[model samples]
Target: MNNMSVELNYGYNGAIQPYNKQFKSNFSGFNHFEVGIRYMFSEHLGAKIIYKSDKFVNDPGGNIGIQYNSLGAGVVYNIGKKIGLTYLTRDNLGLLFHLEGSVGFANSLIQQYESEKTKIIGIGITPQYRINNKIAITTDFTYNINLKQLYGFDGFPINTTKISETGSFYNLSIGLIYYIGENKYHSDWY
Candidate 1:
């Protein structure tokens, strides 16, 4: 199989404490989305180019919303193969682990708040079920921390979020990955 793949995901996203007051819920519905390309150099090591977005809103009538968009580069590893799970891969199951760094902007979706530039760090794991040689289904959970964020989740100026003026958020997503190649099994399975 070849080494290229693309993924699309969408699900729930939320802002965590130190960035927001304890008054808002983190679950912002199905507004979180991600699309990315992946390439494996070997069965165990790889890299990804990603664009992800998350929208956050306060409770009904709360009149607050924020959106964050990011572009990331990350190192990925196939954990399924390393732990003697090649059998699972043969049976159409897989797992990946990643750590990424990103640069992006956050803005208030419905207010005059200015867009703020920020940097972020994230770690995640994805579990996959291959539906066929060319397609697979995956679920991912990622925890990310924002660095150099200048405002709080409420779109207000904040002195600092935490250490180094940072805030945190997370995403839980489901997606599809399409493999491009001419074999019955991609490197993830073969």
Candidate 2:
């Protein structure tokens, strides 16, 4: 299987606010980004390392201007090929599902609150349409859970210091993936 590839993505992302009635700064925008490298050991399975950033901002954002940066690793499964559905779309379409784990830090642009770090676990689904032998267009959707998150996006501490407090977010993106090496077809499209 020809399976080395790189991906770039950009799109919208949002975080579910801290459930507390804290004066949370509103955050919204198209500030999600992802860059990753993938390597497949076989036709149906692969692994990847990715870097992701999500920036949330608003006019006069105050603490709303926050950036979350994460580095993650995942195992990928090509569902389309795994189930013997490669006959569709002239074999130009594919779907991938992944489970990932990451560790990252959140920084506030206003410099009022101390930066906080957290571990994250997420699930993602990507649908791809091949444009050529080497390139494909893709859309991705992911949901991530933030573990032991102690601060809100507004850069303020939550009402409680419980170590188990968690937060969640979702990312929706569109971008492209480029397969590398001299192969007639990438594992995604073959």
Candidate 3:
């Protein structure tokens, strides 16, 4: 059989907050979209490439937004025909992190400001369970490194915030897969 597959993912990101609430920066809640293609070398081995995009609004006053465009390539290993595990290496194609704080008046002076523009590369892993021929459940965990911190209105200059400590950020997702293909029939197997 020609074991090639294409998958698409649609999901949402919840729990949008900074690791430390004292930082006064947080991500906006948003929907995510991903598309990928996989080629199976055998029932036990395969490789895939994927692209993803995310958009959202931020907090504290001015609109906060984050955009992630990434390309990931990975290998998959199946446990029998019912379950599989995958490891991926992802590169952040483009990333933007923005934060804006509340404006104020001091002695008849008004201040306004916003922070923007940050990018990085990352890696991830995914584990999936197939319930049957056409349906499966999947989850993923991802971590990014050397990312620029969110811009602050009065604290840091553009691209001057503390760089993300390596191995500092990660994401988890759970979702379903629907396969579309014609089932093959073999006379000898029957």
- Taking the tens digit of each residue's C-alpha lDDT, what string does model 1 give over 1-190? 6888999999988677444565545535677999999999988899999999987777664467677889999999999888857684475788999999999788865576678889989999999898988999999999999978776766666653333377888889999999987767677877
Candidate 3 C-alpha error for residue 17, in Å = 11
Model 3: residues >4 Å from true position, as ranges?
12-25, 28-30, 60-62, 79-122, 146-168, 184-190
Check candidate 2 and list the clashing pairs: none
* Model 3 TM-score on a 0 to 1 scale: 0.52
lDDT of 2 by residue, 4-40 (tens): 9999999988777653344444575688999999998
lDDT of each: 0.82, 0.82, 0.42
For model 1 the TM-score comes to 0.90
RMSD in Å for candidate 3, one decimal?
11.6
Write candidate 3's Cα lDDT for 1-190 as tens digits.
Answer: 4466666666654323233344355443434666767666665566767666544334554243444455656655553333211222111111111111111110100124343334434455555555555555666555444244443222222244545322123445555555545654111010
For each candidate, give its TM-score against the true structure: 0.90, 0.90, 0.52
What is the lDDT for 126 in model 1? Answer: 95
Candidate 3 or 1, higher lDDT: 1
